[model samples]
Target: MANVLIIGAGGVGQVVAHKCAQVPEVFEKITLASRTKSKCDKIAEMLPRKIDTAQVDADHVGEMVALIEKVKPDMVINVALPYQDLHIMDACLETGVHYLDTANYEPPEEAKFEYKWQWAYHEKFEKAGLMALLGSGFDPGVTSVFTAYAKKHHFDRIKTLDILDCNAGDHGLPFATNFNPEINIREITANGRYWENGEWVTTKPMEEKRVFDFPEGIGEKDIYLLYHEELESLSKHLPEIERARFWMTFSPNYLKHLEVLQNVGMTSIEPIEFQGQEIAPIQFLKALLPDPASLGPLTKGKTCIGNIIRGSKDGQEKIYYVYNICDHQECYKEVQSQAISYTTGVPAMIGAKMMLEGKWMKPGVWNMEQMDPDPFMADLNQYGLPWQETWLDKPFR
Candidate 1:
């Protein structure tokens, strides 16, 4: 058994706390923290067993260090905002604890996503003999591990990869994001990018669209090309891959509302003078949107996210697709959260388990694909998010 301190009490944080509590044999002691102690308290109440709760602004490194010193956890599971990742890492280093995060670090001032910021900490973590697992969420987490599993067991080499994320659930809102509104808006409105022929290619937001006939009755949906952080690391770690890209489905209703929001400058990240106060339009908009956690009970339907790879198994061209389907209401029934948070949070817990169990432990910061995939993949089915795999007749275009 190991002690764990989880940061952030948002929707994903709730799932992480619940999932961690469920595995008492692995996570013996649990403490949940966030900016608001009440949020942490609310989540702790939903858990099956008792757990400690605290409050700390993850943006402040000193505050995080103090909290880690107080809790003295064996590892810190970061489900906080992307901007606070580095600060949490700094605190974990000072407290001599291991680290794991769902999303990578994104500068608060810029609408960009890159792994360089966290990748720079490899030397520090290596010297300290502490392991830091980055991008342990669904896309960068499971999808990357899926690739490694394929490479290990199926493929002689992987040439091309396509990651598809589809959320067919509707929360009965005219406009809302599944997670944080500010982060969600910034990501969709940004330019799209993918890797091809060992080079980076860029496109206008939602420029490339495809209709995929999903399995298990999820049916066909419009998926658009987007520059997810996983594309960068997957290409780098799996250098044999010639092309790699990430795609996510969006409803027409969502696209129209987003367009209107963009035309009116409501999605802009830059702060402007408002009634003698400087406030980012997107931040203010986040205040007006529905909190993603509240949508759990209202949402219906399921989410499908997976990877399709085309490569050579024995000098003959072949294709393989592997993915998981999660239901919103089912997740809420189990963890009081929707599928988005459940999917991301489950992987975060499993990653922590792998580190604490010495299954994927090592010094230095590493992405999901850099580790062994079999054990993590096995845990997914044993946990809440079970995956399906099959041979594809055609390649994704």
Candidate 2:
């Protein structure tokens, strides 16, 4: 058992706290901290086991380091914003504690996000004899682990990979996002990219569309190809992959709202004068939108996300797909969160459990795929998010 500290109070953070409390054997003690102390206290109140709560600005390394020292947690699970990733990592390094986060680092002024910044800390973590796990959430987390499992058990060489993420949940509110409004809007409005033939290919936002028939009666939905951070690490870790792409399902209604917002410049990150004050249009728009955390009770439907790989095994070409389907209502019934947060949060707890058990403890920064997938796969079944596999005759592309 280990004492764990969670940083963040959003939907994902709430789910992470609840899930961690459920497994006392792995997490002997847990503390949930965030910029808002009430949010952390509220989430802690719902857990089956007692959990401590505190208020700290994750963006301030000094504050975070001080809190870490006070709590003396064995590990810190960062479910905070991408902008605070480096600060939390720095604090972890200072205190010689393990670090894990769901997303990669993205600059506050720029919408651009990449793994290079976090990957640069490999040597620092190694030197400090501490471990840092990057992208342990759903897409970059479970999806990456799915690819590694395929490579280990089914494929001799993986050449192509297509990661399909479908969120069929409806939050009742017409314009609310399933996660942080600013982060969600920025990610969708940015230029799309994919890896192919040793180079990055760019496209206009939501320009490339395809329809995928999801498994388990999830039906068909329109998916748009986008550049995700997972492609970078997957390409580097799996050299045999010649082409890699990430696609996400978007409803027509959602696209229409996004288009209107884009046309009115409401999605722009640039600051403009408003009422004699400078304000970012996108940030203003986020204020107008409903918070993702409040949608759990109203959200309904499911999310299907997984990886499809094409490779060769024993001189024979093979195609395999591994995925998980999570229902929002079911997730809410279990953990009082929608499927998006539940999907991401469950894996965060599992990864922490692996580290606490010393199954994946190492002194270096590592991606999810670098660790053994067997224990993770088993944990998926034991936990809330269960997965399934199927052999396809050909790639979805």
Candidate 3:
């Protein structure tokens, strides 16, 4: 039995709290915290098992340290904003508690996502005898594990990897995001990037597009290339990779709305004087948009996300596709969240469980691929997200 503290009361946090509570043998105590204590209380009320709730300013290391000391949690599951990642890591380091987060760190002033800031903590965590697991969410989380599993069980050398993420869920809203609107818009509006032949290639956002027929009757959707945090770690860990790219599907209506928002500068992260006060346009727009957590009851359809790897095994070239399809209604019925949050939160809980159970315990900063995928893969199936694999004679990219 172990105590776990989750710092985020969003949709993902709700799912993580529920999943962790499901496994009582591993998580004896659970605490949900956020800047707003009421949000934590709302999630805690839905949990079958009792959990503690607190208000914490995750942006302040001292505040987090105080909470960590009070809760005395074995580890901290950070589903908070990407900007707060460093602050939480600092608190974990000071308190000697383990750390895990879904996304990488991004400065609040700049719309950039990279692992360099987190990777800098490698020596600090090692010296402190603490463990920090980065990018344990669906894309960087499950995709990383799928690649590692393929390498261990099927492939000799993985030369090419295409990470395809498709969300067919419809919330019936004409222009709304599946996750945090500010974060989601910033990521999609940025330039697209991919790794090839040992260097990064940049392209205009949504410049490259393709159509793929997703398995299990998900059908074909238009997917666009984007720069994901996983490409960086996957390239470093899986050195044999020659080419790597990430893709996600978007509807034309969504694209149109985004283009209009960008043209009018609503998507801009820059601060502007509004009624003699400086405010970020994107943040203000986010306040006007619907909360992603509320989309659960209205969302329907499914999501397909996986990795397609091509390389040689046993002296012959081969290709494999591994992916999971999650339904929005099903996730809502189980945990009151859409598949996007469900996909991410499920892995966050599993990663934390692995650490607490000593299945992935180590003293250093690491990515999901650095750990053994066996336990994680098994938990994925046992949890809400079940995945399948297929052998392809030709590459999808």
Q: Which candidate is the best by lDDT?
A: 1
Put down candidate 1 lDDT per residue, 89-189, tens digits, no spaces: 99999989999999999998899999999999999999999999999989889999999999999999899999999999999989989999988999999
C-alpha lDDT of residue 244 in model 2: 96
Model 3 C-alpha lDDT per residue in residues 1-397, reported as the tens digit of each score:
9999999999999999999999999999999999999999999989899999999999899999999999999999999999999999999999989999999999999988899999999999999999999999999899999999999999999999999999998899988898999999999999999999999999999999999999878899999999999999999988889999999999999999999989999999999999999999999989989999999999989999999999989999999999999999999999988999999999999999899889998999999999999999999999878999999877876
User: How high is the CA lDDT of each candidate model?
Assistant: 0.95, 0.94, 0.94
TM-score for all models, in order of appearance = 0.99, 0.99, 0.99
* Clashing pairs for predicted structure model 2, backbone only: none
The regions of model 3 sitting more than 4 angstroms off are: none
Regions of model 1 farther than 4 Å from truth: none
Score residue 125 of candidate 1 by CA lDDT.
99
Model 2, TM vs. native:
0.99
Which whole-number lDDT from 0 to 100 does residue 331 have in model 1? 98
1 against 3, candidate with superior lDDT? 1
Root-mean-square deviation of Cα positions for candidate 1 versus the true structure, in angstroms: 0.6
As for lDDT, the candidate ahead, 1 or 2, is 1
